[model samples]
Target: MTSTAATTEATEKWSGQLRANGRRVTKQRLAVLTAVEHLPHAVADDVAAAVRGDLPDISLQSVYVVLADLTEIGLLRKIEPPHSPARYETRVDDNHHHAICTSCGRIEDVDCAVGHAPCLTPENTHGMTIEIADVLYRGTCADCAAQAS
Candidate 1:
C-alpha cells in the first residue's frame, strides 16, 4: 500500500483504539501516534519535532502526556536504556528484546528466539510466575565495526 494510505489506515486504527479506551481523540494525540509509527524507537524530542511538521504549536509537555497515556493503554512500548533517553515504538503484544550499538547508540528490535513472548526458560523460578522477559544486547553495529576496521 502507498505510504499515505497506510498512514490513514493507521490513524483510523489508533483513533478507534482511543475511543475504545474511552479517551477522546484529539489532533495532538493522533499526530503523536503517527510520529511514533513513522519513527519507532524515537525519543520524546524526536516525536515532538515530527509532530511539529503538522502541529507547529504542540508543546513538548503535550507530547510527553500523549506518550505516557498511549503507553499506559498498551498501544505503545517504551524502552529505557541506561544513560539514554527513553524511546517509544508501536510494536507491542509480542515480548521482544533489543540490540544496542555501544559505539553509536542505535537500537533495533530483536524477536524472541523461540517465536513467542517470554522466550527464556529459567531453571529456577523461585516460586515466581514469569510473564515477560526484557533483554538488551550491546555491541557495535555493522557500520560502527566497519568504521573501526
Candidate 2:
C-alpha cells in the first residue's frame, strides 16, 4: 500500500483503540500516533516535529501528553535508555528487546532470542510472577561500526 494509505489505516486503527478504551480521539492524538507509527523509537521532540507536518500548530507538550496517554493505554511502548530521552513506538504486544547504538543513539527492535514471552528466565522473581522482561542491549550499529573501522 502507498505511504499515505498506510498512514490513514494506522490512524484509523489507533482511533479505534482510543475509543475502545473510552478515550476521546483528537487530531493531535492521531497525528502523534501516526508519527510514532512511521518513526519507531522516535523521541518526543522528533514525534512533535512529524506531527507538526500535519498539524502546524501542535505543541511539543501536546505531543508528550499524547505519547504518555497512548503508552499508558498499551497502544504505544515507551523505551527510556540511560542518559537518553524516552522514545516512543507502537510495536508492543510482544516480548521484544531493543539494540541501542552507543555512538549514534539509534535504536532498533530485536525479537526475543528464544521466541517467547518473558524471553529471559530470572533466577528469582522476589516472590512475584514475571510477565514481561525488558532488556536493552547496548552496542554500536552497523553504520557506526563500519565508520569506526
Candidate 3:
C-alpha cells in the first residue's frame, strides 16, 4: 500500500472505526480512504476516477464496495444534497454541514455550531435512530453572487 503519513493518521481513526463496526482492514479500503482524504466531498464516480490513478486495476465495483464498506463503518460520510449525486468525505467526527452553490454546483464545508457529533437534534424524532444531523444550505456562492451583481 502506498501510505502517506497524513493518510495513515486518518486511516488510523478509520481502522479503529472499522474494527469497532466489525469490518476488516484491506488494501481497497486504504485506496478508497486515501482518495477521500485527498478529495473530500467527492462523488462516487469521482473517487473511482481518483483511485484508478493509483491502483490501475481497481474496478469501479471495487470502489463502490470500499465506499459502501467505509460508509457502513462510519469512516466516511455520505452527503446527498438534493438534485446531486451522493458525495463522500473522510472527516467523520465533526458533524459538519455543507453549503451548495446553485449556479456553480460547488459545495463547501461548515463545521457544526455545536462542534461535535450529532450537532443538532431534530424537533421530531418520529421514533427513528439518529446518528447525525446535516445541513445543506443552498445559495449562490461568492463568485456566482458577484457575477449576478
Candidate 4:
C-alpha cells in the first residue's frame, strides 16, 4: 500500500531467493541487498555507504561483487544510465523502462505500457530475436524543473 511496504516486500523476496539459489545469505550481500531494496535504483557507491554503516568492515568492492553475484542469480537488477554509475534494484522480470533526469542523473522506474519483455514492437526484426529491451526516457525531473524556475 505504501512505498516502504512495497520495498520491504521486495527485500523479503530477495532473502528467500538467496536461500533458493544456494547462497549462504552472507552479511555483505544482505547489507547491500537491503540498501538497494530500501532505495531502488541506488548506485553502488550509495549502497556501499549504506552497507558500511551496518557492516563496518564491508568494502565497496564487496558490495559490487555481491551485486554482480545477485544479478547473475536473478535476485537483483542492474541498471546503467548514460554517463552515470550502475544502479541496483530488486524489481526485476518486468518489461519496464526508466526515466532518467538529464540534469541531476536521478533514475526512476517506469513500467512498460505494453506486455512482457521486448515490449516494444520493432519496425524491423533486424534478423534477430529480441529477448529484452532497455528504454531510457531522458528529461529533467520535476525537482529539477522547479529548481530551474
Q: Where in model 2 is the C-alpha error above 4 Å?
A: none
Q: What is the C-alpha local distance difference test score of each model?
A: 0.93, 0.91, 0.85, 0.85
List, residue by residue over 28-146, the lDDT tens digit for candidate 1: 98999899988999999999999999999999999999999999998889999889999999998799999999999999999998987689978998999998788999999999999
Number of the top candidate by TM-score? 2
Off by over 4 Å in 1: 124-128
Tens digit per residue, CA lDDT, model 2, 12-72: 8888999998899999888888889889999999999998999999888888888998899
Residue pair clashes in candidate 3:
none
Taking all chains together, each candidate's TM-score versus the true structure is: 0.93, 0.93, 0.82, 0.85
**Which residue pairs in candidate 1 have backbone atoms (N, alpha carbon, C) closer than 3 angstroms, thus clashing?**
none
- Quote the positional error of residue 53 for candidate 1 in Å: 0.8
| Predicted candidate 4 versus true structure: per-residue lDDT over 1-149, tens digit per residue | 89889767866776787899999867787788788878899988888888888898887888889999999998888888878888889888787989998998888889887877888888898999987788999999999999999
Candidate 3 lDDT over residue span 1-149, tens digit each:
45577666877876776677888877677778888988989998999999888788989888988898788877888999898898999877777899999999999998898977688888999999888887888999999999999
By TM-score, is 2 or 3 better? 2
- Model 4 scores a TM of 0.85
**lDDT for position 117 in model 3:** 69
Backbone clash total, candidate 4: 0
